[model samples]
Target: MKIIAAKKILKANDQLAEENRAGFNAAGVYCVNVVGSPGAGKTTLLEALFTALKDRLRPAVIEGDIAGSIDAARIEKLGVPVVQINTQGACHLDANMIAAAAADFDLAAIDLLVIENIGNLVCTAGFDLGEHLRIVVLSTAEGDDKAAKYPAIFQGSQALFITKADLLPHLNFNAERITADFKRLAPQSEILQVAAIQGDGIPPAADWLAGKCAATLR
Candidate 1:
């Protein structure tokens, strides 16, 4: 019965996700779901991307967290439209939360909608949030075994961002091995090495995403 209940829950979530997708398409907005473990520099990446992506795209954000409005405040300070969803105790954001927070945005005016999911690599990946593509962030400080240890998130993503890349020289993380793992796991996913704080790889990452949003998101 537990398995049955799980299936039922996922079914309901997927139905809601489809509704959210329809809403996004109706507004001509392309959405991307960003997922990663805590302290992976996911928020930092968004901070950098907001500056870089602004040149070509009008972007909005929906920041999800277990609690606190800190990250959401960061995005709003950039003068961009942002909504914060505090999930309380929930491990991940569901389609219902997205559909509700998304209403707060003028989706018609935004071409790119980025949903920064709860900073969790496990429970987060199983839920569909009506995104056109998915990005998974991993930090060098977290070590290199994460892709192998937590395969689900990496396997389902379209881009695997190695954040805090500037720390590579100081850390013991295996860059080549992780790259090889991501390739073997999700060959279709683009791999990016980023140091959001220093602005390394920000433009290329932004350009790649902007290109995808422009060419295929319509």
Candidate 2:
């Protein structure tokens, strides 16, 4: 009975996701869903990304969190359009929530819409929020074995970002091993090492996003 109920919920969510996707397509807005655990530097990466791509793209953000709006506040300081979605106790952002928050944005004015999913690896992997791409962030401080343990998030993502490269020297993380594991699990996904704070590797990441935005607009 529980399994059946879960299926019904996911089915409904998927239908709504399709509707959201169609709406985004009509507006020519390229959206990316960014997922990661807490303290994975998802917001920091966005800060860097926005700074790097500011002139090239008119980007907006839908910040998701369980309670606070701190992430949204940070993005707002960057002078970009941002909407905060406090999920209260929800573990992940679903299509219905996205659909609601998206109404607040003038989608036609935005070239890219980035939905920063609530910080959870497991639950977020089970839900689709109608995004053109899914990027997962794994910080070195989180350890390299996360990819093997949280296979769903890594496997489903279109790109994997290894954040906090600046801390690599102090930590014992094996970048090569982590990259190998990611490649093994998500064979087609692009992998990039980024230190969002120091601005290392921001250009390629920005370039990749720019390419996607151009492709979507085309």
Candidate 3:
């Protein structure tokens, strides 16, 4: 019965998600759902991406948090269209929430829509919010066992952004193990290392995303 209930919820969510996707497709905007554990440098990575592509691509952000507007405020400072979704302890944002929020934006003017999902690995993986791709952020400070322990999130993501690579030398984490484990779980996913603070590897990451955005446009 528990599994049945879960399936019912996901089914309903997927229906709404498809509607949201249709809306995006109509407006010619590509959405990327960013998910990761708290303190994984999701915001920093966004700042890097924004800096890298702001001149070439018109980007917007949707910040999701349990109860605060901190992330949204940060993105707004970057001078882009941003909306904050306070889940009020929901832990995750579903398709319906995104669909409702979609009404507030002029989607046609934006090339890419990035939704920084509430810092969670499990719950966010279960809900589709009409994104063209899902990017999972993992910090070396979080340790190497995250991919193995949170297989669902790792496996569901399209690409993995290993943030905080600058901390690699100080930590005991093994990037090789994390890579192998992610490959074991998500064989087709791409893994990119990024150090948002120093802007290391941000260019390559930006190029990859730019390519994706170009492809979505074509």
Candidate 4:
């Protein structure tokens, strides 16, 4: 039945994910899988984060979208290596897609490989891309109940970034409530509130990423 078929698919994905992890280790690169909903500012955040971490780490991006290369174009304008993976109709990017896209880059020259997953919360959580870390982004405009409604993504992530902090004054977002919910679901994960567009909270985020990358690379 459907359950049996789904298990087979996931099993295949996990096997390839392990292979991808080995490749990352051999290349000495730290990879992060970034997931969020559309308009969650995933690309905008990366645009700024790349600038902040550029001098410290050679970072590259693998931009995934249901279609179009708009996000890839933005990253390329930053003078960094970027690969675009158009899933065509797929909801999430799988390990095989990552392996193919990653092969296009000279991984040895990169210190960080950030795969910006298709703007989504549900499917991406279950599919492992063999990333060293997983980050879930929630925009203040998206409301605070996301953690309660979609615990899988929130629970599985190593970090939660509540983006668009600049809008907090205007929106009736319950910051305290979201914080409590996130802590309950993912007590060990770090939560960072950042206005990625203006770079208000990017430095600390950059520092955290740099430290994680350094430790793994060493």
Candidate 5:
């Protein structure tokens, strides 16, 4: 019975995701769904990325958390449009939730819309939120074996961001091991090392996002 209920939920989600995709296609907005574990610096990376590209891209953020407005508050301070979705206890953000919140934004005016999913490595992987791209963040403090242990999230993502590189010297995290594990799970996904707090290794990410945005326009 549990399996059946889950499938029904996912089916409904996929249908709404298609509807959301149509809306994005009509508005010509590039949307990215960013997922990661709790306290993995998802908000920090987004704040830095948005600050770097805000002038050029007209970016907006949709923050998904279980019950707090913390991430939303951070993005709102950046002088951009932001919507906070408190799942009320849901571990992930589904398509219906995103579509409903999206109505609050002026999608046509926005060049990029980023949906920061509830910080969970497992459940978020199964739901499609109608994003143009899926970016997964893994922090060095979270251990390097995450890709192997949680293959579905890594495999399903288009890009993988290894955050907190500044702490590499003190942690047991091995960059090579993470790379190798990602190679096995998601060979084609671009992997970038980022230190979101110190503002290191972000230009490349911004450039990559810019390229994707331009491609979408073309």
Candidate 6:
């Protein structure tokens, strides 16, 4: 009975996701869902990305959090269109929430829409939030065993960003081993080693996103 109920819920979510996808497609917007554990630097990556891609892409952001609007405030200061969705206590955002939050944005004016999922690596992996691509962020500070331990998000994502590269010298992280595990688990996904603070890997990440946006939106 529990399994059946779960399937029903997922089916309903999938239908809403399709509707959200259609809406994004109609507006020619390329949407990417960004997911990661808490303090994994998802917003910091976006801060750099928004600056890097500003000239080439007219971007908007949907920030999802369990409580505050801190990330939304940061994005708004960048002069980009942004909306915050507070799930109250939910661990992840669903298609329905996205559909509701999206109503506030002028979709026609944006080329890329970034949905920053709640700061969780587990529950967020199970929900499809109507995005063209899924990018997962992992910080070296979180330990190198995450790709092997929490394989679901890495397996489902289109790309993985290993953040905090600048701190690698101070930490005991083995980048090669983690890279191997990620490749073994998510062979098709692209990988980027980023230090968001210094903006080390932002260019390649931005270029990859620009390519995807062109292919989908153009």
lDDT of 4 by residue, 89-151 (tens): 899999999999999999889999999999998999899999999999999999999999999
Query: What TM-score would you give candidate 3 relative to the actual structure?
Result: 0.95
**TM-score-best of 1 and 3:** 3
lDDT values, one for every candidate: 0.90, 0.93, 0.91, 0.93, 0.91, 0.92
Query: In candidate 5, what are the lDDT values of residues 89-137, reduced to their tens digit?
Result: 9899999999999999998789899999999999999999999899999
Sequence-dependent TM-score of model 5: 0.94
Please count the clashing residue pairs in each candidate, in the order shown.
Answer: 0, 0, 0, 0, 0, 0
Question: lDDT per residue, candidate 1, 1-218, as tens digits?
Answer: 34444356589899999999989888889999999998899889998998997767899999999999999899999988999999998999999999999999888899999999999989998888999889999999998998899898899999889999899889999989899888888998788899999999999999998888887665
RMSD (CA, Å), each prediction: 2.6, 2.6, 2.6, 2.7, 3.1, 2.5
The residue-level lDDT of candidate 1 at 56 comes to: 76
Cα-based lDDT at residue 127, candidate 4: 93
- The Cα error of candidate 3 at residue 192, in Å, is 0.6
Candidate with more favorable, higher lDDT: 2 or 6: 2
lDDT of 2 by residue, 1-218 (tens): 34444356578889999899999999999999999999999999999999999899999999999998899999999999999999889999999999999999999899899999999999999988999999999999999899989999898898999999999989999988878888998899888889999999999989989998898779
Worst 10 residues of 2 by lDDT: 1-10
For candidate 4, the C-alpha RMSD (Å) to the true structure equals: 2.7
Residue 96 alpha-carbon offset, candidate 6, angstroms: 0.2
Segments of candidate 3 deviating more than 4 angstroms:
1-8
Q: How many clashing residue pairs, candidate 3?
A: 0
Model 6: lDDT equals 0.92
